[model samples]
Target chain A: MAVRADDIPVPRGRPRLAGRVREWLDQESILGPVFVTPALLLLVLLVAYPFLMALYFAMSNAFIGRPSEFIGIRNFVRLWDSDAFRQTFQNAFVFTGIAVAFKLVFGICLALLLNEQLWFKRFIRGAVLLPWVIPTALSTLGWWWMFNSLYSVVNWTGIAVGFMDPPGPNWLGQKYYAMTAVVTVNVWRGLPFFAITILAGLVAIPRELYEAAEADGAGPVARFWLITLPLLKPVLAIVVLFSTIFTFSDFNIVYVLTRGGPINSTHLFATLSRVVGIDTGRIGEGAAISLYLFPLLVFVVWAQLRFVRKQAY
Target chain B: MEPIRRRRFLTTAAGGLAGILATRVPPARGQQREVSYLCWNNFAPASDKKLAEIGQRFTRDTGIKLKIDHVSHMGPQQAKYASEVQTQAGHDLVEMRMHFPWLYEPQLVDVSDVVGELEKKYGKAISSAYEGAHVNGVWRAVPQYHGMFVATYREDLFKKASLKVPDTWEDLYTVGKELKKMGNPVGIPISQNYDSISTAGPVLWSFGGMEVDKDGKTVRINSPATAQTIEWYKKMFRDCMEPEVLSWSDASNNESIQQGKAGWIHNPVSAYIVAKQRKLVTADGINHHRSLGGPQGRHETDTPRHIGIWKFSKNVEPAKEWIRYLLGKREVYDEYIMSGDAFNLPVYDKLQDHPVLRTDPKYAALRGEGVQYHTYGWPAPPSDKVQLITNTYLLPNMLAKAVTGTSTKDAIAWAEIEMRKILAG
Candidate 1:
């Protein structure tokens, strides 16, 4: 016989279960987590898992294809004593510090110039981005050709302009010169990001504030110092932080240009990691070398975030 | 009723997940024969074309499929091999170069059967071939070919300087100095490049210096002979070579000679071949000769190539068959050499007199140079430790440190320390 829904003896937990599920489905908080579950899972698998694996590998005596043993901090300790690793660590700091500083200065100058009412402004902005827009490996190859000792166009230009004596400078042959050449290329490639980003920040600044600063009898320099600089601090901090990270772990420019050469003068953390980890098949040491900069990068990023948060508050 | 529905839903979802995972799992193979080979980019495109043609022919003959992957021969290729060995996955067959057979010996399959069969047909292989492919009394790989380093120089420059072609290291230095005075410097890469390692090998050996002993257990880089080699390089860097040699890549020496700025280079015949092919410089403008003799003896560096099947490969038999087929037939091997423009030298004694070498005047000297060819860590059996040192470029870096102003004693001392650390590890 057919039975009514209420006529059937209600299961002991049926009503409670229905109520709980309905409440969970109806609540926005529950829905929020449910909707984000896929993304969270992806984040764990893609980003967090590899990062954790790298951490594990760094602590183990792992060679590619060979079984690994837990070696504690031996990899880190060895890298600490390694002359090559020490030099690479030092190179990372110097290369990033100089590259970021120049990128900022040039970026701001170019942004200011581009902001002015001028002919071909759009064209100039787009053209300025070619170095950034091109694939880094391909662009660096072009730079390599230009830095060639015998067939370098830069040397050719210098010779024709009489700015250099015969034979010209070997742009990538000496320690100091190679460092300078890599830094210059880094700056050249990174400038567009800063320019476009800072330009956006510049455009976002309300015109009324600048007008008021000028009305208060401020000169161009005074208005810039009082209004433009303060207004651009947050954006500048962000751009600089990104550029710093990119420069610190940079592999393509150094690898393509010198392969950290002329005697390991230009090796960065990434190239050194490859040399140790992949090339030498010392995955453990390579992993340790790569992660050595993690703590410093965390500090830099955290400080920038805190500064941004303080400004926001 | 509600609990039952929820349980049903959970079960359905779990089953769906299981189904997805099952689909992702590779299906079991019955008897389909297929293998993939990974190798470095050939010096000439025609060489790759020849290889592909042979692969297709193999497929036709045996009903087995062959796939070949060619990658750049430098850093990336090394990384690929390391990755494959570490992961225990990738390519059924791989081209092993230099010290790789020894470096990854545990992961490679024994190819004694292939090598033995081929040797029975083609006489004895060269000693250098055995030096690279045979490790621990096991044939780890099949010796493929040798890329010999010979001197490529400008005949025009030598004529203008009224100097004969250098037959010894001293003569090279003397000629190099004269060329430099004329603003045409000899370009021997003093930097950390593959060519630098090859160029340094002969010099170090010629001076009777070695990085390791014949047992591959002792560090011998701190000898007086090594110190003398360092001093000689310092003088060469100061007087004969351009400062730019410190930063030269593997391609720089080729470019320097092609552009008419370099008077001499120690490279494979690729430079000369390219110059003639491109007409960047005419054939008459360029000339090639055997490596210069050092005080100890006349020797050259050999970057031998080998073929090995991975232990983890599913189609090991097919991989072995492919290697045997490629290396066994003299006609096919000679064709490969011809296609490569004589860039690849035969490892078998019988094929040494192949028409490819005998026909070309430029390749004549190289034909017999293999007898005098030596690999790095020479006299010493190549080991993983030795491979690590080679890859890290410790030897070249030592010379660079010395030539760039670090004292010879200090440079050798540093190298000894580095070598010890590598060996100990």
Candidate 2:
């Protein structure tokens, strides 16, 4: 039965004025929107405006430090038809999909490992985050050294250990290996954040809930599925969302590791954008590549948010 | 007595006035001197340390302050300096990256006229550094330095393979194929954002490719010479260069050579300094030497980098004095070249022609044989727009595309279109 107006329950210690304000605020989503407005404005100014400017640029022939001629979608049309841009689009999707998928699986496994009680737990915890804690530039440089064709320890180890033939693999050399190397570097750098987030969620899970499940004779996997996962659903949703955006837009890994590759095998949006915009000075085309990444990003964000809202306790 | 005293006073006053006039007029005839230096990159790389030293010496010899704000090399560093210039900065001297010449030429005080005066006072702008800067009805630059390219190979590998030193692109290719079968790489820098003009010049000239006419006219994207050279270059990569070469845009690939990972390359003559620095070669150890031409018949080497007074310099006299002392002063030039801290060429062409160059029993032969005999940069693209061609990526991309199944006709057409667009802008 629908509660009658007079029978509605008021929150404890709520004054009449507070109740009226709450009702009004609730109806219009007033404070909710106001709480969100700062972020909204920042996004519009920083992300949206630059993006729209890029979109506008993509419709014309523009150069760096110079005025552009309006060509009415000619730049976009040309870019879309071009082999380089097409390859860039394909690369972005493949890289993000593969990277995110690996991060999710690896992140969960890492989170589970870290959740266990072990000696030097705090030290081990900090060490696990060393990759993420180091500046991207420095660590990327370290990776570059490690992957150097002649001087690489990785290559040296491979050859010495009879892992392969005489010359071992140049981790960043061939087309296929270049992509794999780039993806591996990216996953290695990014997995820490997700694992930490999930680990935090795992910690917050009530001991009583697991105890109760065990008392009811629920098996290990059943307890995980019924209680732990259901509880962590909100956290995992947020984790996937954050990692997707980070992995999708990372430029430094691709740049330092492979720089697209021997055959454009690893060209992603950001590197391709720089090549076209800064290097070639085809500012319009480069802007177009970045702008194109937006809708796909938006779709992922929306899906994540929807999943998050559904999982709220 | 009173009449005598009045006459004395008048005589004293007149004498004082005469004394003041004499002092003022003599001082007016004295001259103040100024020196100016340009920041053009090709020449000024060595100019900085050498001039700073000379500036210190000049201060000891003559009482004058030296101003050195010429230019930095192109690519990222000059971007820092360009912002300073654009905002109406009073740059004293800058190490100019060529092509920004358009940005600097009009702004700098013309030191061309003063260079000849300094030459008489000292000697001609270090004879060999002069790649004809004062011709074509324009007097803008003065001569500076040359860091040319030459061919280098691995001694151990070449000895084992029993391959002769490559004379041309074909021989380099042959050597690469044979070496690669042994799992060694021919480490030619296919991507030359590292030494764009120096590296590209020798390869193009090795196959006899013309850049642009010294008089700026049109794009020569697919000259038969350039096309043939590119075809050979692609084969060099295909046969010898490792997958790592594609990943590198800088000297990391050269470092591969130093690390003993690769075999032959057409590299900077400066590679000798690298080998020595890494202790790969010494009075005791073995190392390879590069000459002008390779197995290729006709060749080109880089013009020694040239220094010019930026039309922008404030201290033309001091700059001119500093440039002169650095170039022609025997002690200064020798100190710079022998240090091996930087790549420096001799001031006099005759010094290079001595036993030290071709027949120096100790110094490895760099005769006319493999050395491409052309010089660049003292005269290059007249405008900054055309200067884009001198960069590493544009041509290499075109060539890479062509080799990776991009049809030559289509490739040339596409390259020309892209090049003309960049050149025009």
Error of 2 at A123 (Å): 1.0
TM-score of chain B of each: 0.90, 0.76
Residue B96 of model 1, lDDT score: 78
Q: What digit string (tens of lDDT, one per residue) describes model 2 on residues A1-313?
A: 8979889876666597788887878875687797899999999999889777877777777655446788876655566655556777888888888998998889888988899998898998899898899888789888888877667788788778888775567576566677788888888998899889999999999899989999999998998889978898899889888887787778888777766765466888887777666544556766777667677789989988988887783
Docking class of 2: incorrect
lDDT scores for all predictions?
0.86, 0.63
Interface RMSD of each: 1.6, 5.0
Top lDDT model:
1
- Error at B157, model 1, angstroms: 3.2
TM-score of 2: 0.70
> Candidate 1, A102: how far from true, in Å?
0.8
> Candidate 1, residues B289-336: lDDT per residue as tens digits?
777887788778888899988899988888988987788777777777
